[model samples]
Target: SRILLQDTSAVPTSPWTHFVMMAGSTLRKVKSRSWKKQRHFRLLEDGMTIWYKSRWAGKGHSTFSVTEVEAVREGHQSEVLLSIAEEFPADLCFTLVFHGRQGNLDLVADSPEEAQAWIQGVRKLIHKVQTMDEKERLDQWVWDWFQKADKNKDGKMNFKEVRKLLKMMNVDMNEDHALHLFTMADKSESGSLEIEQFVHFYKILTQRDEVWKVFQDYSGDGEKLMLEELENFLMMGQQEGERSAQLAQELIDSYEPSESGAMSLDGFQKYLCSQEGSIFKPEQRDLHQDMSQPLSHYFISSSHNTYLLEDQLRGQSSLEAYIQALKRGCRCVEVDCWDGSDGEPIVYHGHTLTSKILFKDVISTVKEYAFKASDFPVILSLENHCGVEQQTIMAEHLSQILGDMLLTTVLDGQVPQQLPSPQELKGKILLKAKKIGGLEDCIDETLTDEVSDEEEANGDAESPSAEDPPAESLTENDKVKPRKSKSKLSKELSDLVLYCKSVHFHGFEQARLHGKCYEMSSFSESKAKRLAKEAGTDFVQYNTRQLSRIYPSGLRTDSSNYNPQDMWNVGCQIVALNFQTAGLEMDLSDGLFRQNGGCGYVLKPDFMRDGNTQFSPEKPEERPDYKPLRLSIQVISGQQLPKVNQKEGSIVDPLVRVEIYGVPQDQAKEETSHINNNGFNPVWNETLNFILHTPELTLVRFVVEDYDKASRNDFIGQFTLPFTCIQAGYRHIHLLSKDGTPIPPSSIFVNISISELT
Candidate 1:
């Protein structure tokens, strides 16, 4: 095995670090209580991977890398571990949580000391992996592949093993060319190469010709890029403008840099692949947008059924879900309340088998994580299904648990003509629920109010009947009524609703004449899409003053999501989707909110934010200041994509698809033809073009899928970014898994061109 560091002699070896590695132990691997089985597990000699096998199976062992683990949880942190709490002591149990929706591995140690040794040992390895530099990380990635390719476990790879490794890495190479590189790296007639030789082979194989071409264009000579050449490249090639010289010096010092202010081809590649070289503008990744506008003038990062970790009907309701959502910069989260078996109100899907959590617990979670991701306000969109008595209890919990974090009274002691800014409401939790009338209607002592708008508030006038939703391929159970008929509001809870008051969305004209800036309406996806289609200009105009929320349809029982960009195109602010579900829908939502400091709010374009704006999703071209852009993307190559198939001999044939989501005319996709038997480093020099109207609302999604003829293409990885954030230059797009988590080192190199469409 290859050493992770250059100097191993200087490092001291601790007893606890190797306790699990040197002396493998038998731990009880658990899923359900009925499925607990003893397994032999140990960390490998490389200290980067874990090997485990069922005690009963002679040669059926499985291995996963330490880098794959997102975190390590203790005791009953997971549902599976919680289920078997009675059988195992809390101190003796732990769970390994993998990244990107992979099921967790729950285990029970024979003793607390053994559990601690395993937990601490694994965590130490994880920390070391996390702190590695990009170059070191790349080295780790290569080592992982070497481990996988050395099938005989002889600590060396023969030509046959190297050839198979090429296929496993998703590379298709000519036999003679592969042999030439292999022989050169081997440097001996042994015909068997060790770990160092494999690393050398990878370096020779991955010489990025495309990046070298651009480097040569700017460099006086291809050997190195001096200060002047780098400055010019940043100015002309990367649009760095006035900061080009200073940024060039910074890049040179940061990446494979030199004190002499010169950058080699490798250093140049490193700079471009770094966050500074990403197609996304680094400035937009901070709090750059003006945040003082009224709440309705921005798009909010939101989640529907924020308490559910899985599907609605039977998923577990967890406080962790709320924490996850808030930590991901979700400024708005839905809480479906119900009358619990006890006096306290509980949160869960009303008419489903989903587990329940105490409402107070949810409130505590909200207070803790509301400002963790962003100091902006968090709207707790409450769907009240409880009686007046429990609703009062809910109010008490909200007041006591959230304390000062809850916004109980209106700012300025009275409702204003317009809503408050996210800047003004920072660190506060705003309640979004049915209120009696207006703020004046709420009396401190006399709190109960009549329920008058349930019918209208329940569904938009144009919303397809819940009983007959738009055609969606879903299980019957997904249609389970998520709430009860609207109940009267408790004065205590009603007072907490200062800004986001749920009301019926009447026609556009009615709202224009009588709408309160503090008033907001929730629309099912179908209704929102219909309104966006029928009244695109009006929808955009109305959103400027009052807030509009678009949620997934009731038919999404599987917790599926609709495209949020459609609603965003019409300037809808709170276009909520199932954060628990991962796909193109959530990708677009994450992409939009990913910028502006990830503060959970993105200011809409100037045209969309103006009260009298003529911007319309339907006729974007007709709007003033409609600078349509033609985007051409040259899909270069994919690096280190995750394997789609787990089987030993199954290599992937991948294809890249570039998709645009915006107004009707702007929504299109073009794809590259599949490359057969390659997933390691697939290349496709194909250019895809998109003409984008409403560029402010447009999102470009790059999807890499393993092509299959007999079945649906298997998803490899995807990346989504708003067109407005895209930088025109040679860039690297780091790809994410289906669940929107980074699959490290899996990225695509692309050449971007954006120009005026005229």
Candidate 2:
């Protein structure tokens, strides 16, 4: 029986405490940089460091931090060949590459299980290190402040010292209020404030004002809100089924233990900032959206090079990539198919040293995990390089695995004049590939007699032509050339292309004239941007009826992604992004799709969907009736700002940037003044304003950055909300990490106001 090796690296597991024996060899330097063997490696310090013994007896051992390690399971040694000698089971061997201050260390494990264990242990330690680093920074910050405020070299601060510290923090407290706080903190009657008391006092001071402001906004009666008003506020924007007066009353009863049947400011604050009171409004999960519109009318969460987890050149491709992308609500996935050994088609990068997985396995995986995240249709963007025989095998695997879930024919027949809505094909998987259809028929008819005679003379045998060569037989040099061959899709495969038949995009005019339902075209990011610039209005008009996909250009070999909003601005539905990457681009993508229940589909704006509306990225002046809105934001201060690194005495010069993302003409941004040398309680009493035209479709993002004069500014935290959902008046903006999870106890206090122009 084959040993099973499940990919669990991406899955979160408890940190490992015990160590397992593992034999690995590391590369050491004999002279300047000559490679020499160093044997007998042991994972030490709970897998936080690796210590390897020198070859010489009684020699000193060198250690490297596991946090800097990069480990990967070895796949096929050769890309062009499929021989057993070059292929090894992933469970048998793996490699580890470590980057450290001394230099780089490359090592290889003797067994796969051992490598897997080491990698898992190292990852756990890395996470633990990061957590510890954060805690240590906070501790240091407390100590630094305590030492500074402890006048006369004392261990604690008296009321005068505490008052001085408050002043330094830009906080103003009346004498009576300060005395009350000092008395409350001096629990032991020592008449001095310790580090713990100081920290607790600061938290209370920051949280009180925020709570009162929120209460005043919701409680129209000024002091408190009635039970009915509190219930309405809690159930705001919730669907009718979810909004229950009883539930709201229960929440009020839990927070407000008063006989007056009213929620006080303190009670409201506790409920609003608690885990139960999420900033994101509750949305109904059922398909309540207008499913009658064509699939082209929705923006899809898509992935470019779905198999790659790193750089395109030598990144490892595995089934886990597919699983991760699918679980993240990616509706469209790419599969580069080529002929594999043993009559099975394989999926991988065509000419790189990347490993391959059986085409059938990919199909089976997709079938199992396709609808796990979303019930909407999945589009398999097939880049076929397989012969007719292997293509048939690929089709058989798909049909057998997916069964009736695979859309094999047009829904309701009648040659759909418009594409079917997502509701019409909920659990279906659509294949987007070139097929022998209308355009192919025209091309076949237009073929010159000389070419037809040559084909007839060869007895119509499917031999290897320059256009369709055996992919495996091509050498590295030959693979460099473009392999743009007409797909010889078999009847079985062509029949599966129900609603995503791939077509080459000619120009704006040609696509508008000849495009039909289920006929989709794709363009590289550069080409799409050029078309948008050159023919913005025509392109927008063309997308109203047909679907178009925009992918990253081949020049983005580093697996970096372009700003998908640029493509989205022109109303392109499927703007593919490199999901493996994490940056501003991916953040925007996540923010956009985070709406609509994160169902991997967002309905296109009404202006873009209307055929009669003449929308152009270039000619925003033409829309005379577009109302403009003035937005004013006051950046006040931040509470418990997170430390970016573990270094002591490190201070953050924080600045708040407000960005408005929408159409080209509607975009606007502004930044508040920076506060120097303060991560904890940095205050910038500056107001930034912007005039936005398309406020309804705009996204307002607040990004906090730590400014540095000698280096690039580092991201502190950020939060993005749709302009429509932003609440005005004094609001406590919760900061979120790069992955959109809220950072607890870290928030920014701000005032927002919006006014519409006549």
lDDT measured at residue 599 in model 1 versus the true structure, 0 to 100:
92
The C-alpha stretches of model 2 lying farther than 4 A from their native spots are 1-206, 213-251, 257-260, 274-288, 438-487
- Candidate 2 least-lDDT 10 residues: 455-464
In model 1, state the lDDT of residue 345.
92
Per-candidate TM-scores read 0.90, 0.69
Please write out the lDDT profile of model 2 over residues 349-431, one tens digit for every residue: 77788878878777777886788778999999887778888988888988888899898766664577888898888998988
Q: Which candidate leads in lDDT?
A: 1
Candidate 2 positional error at 313, Å: 1.3
Alpha carbon lDDT of residue 665, candidate 1? Answer: 85
Model 1 worst lDDT run, 10 consecutive residues: 1-10
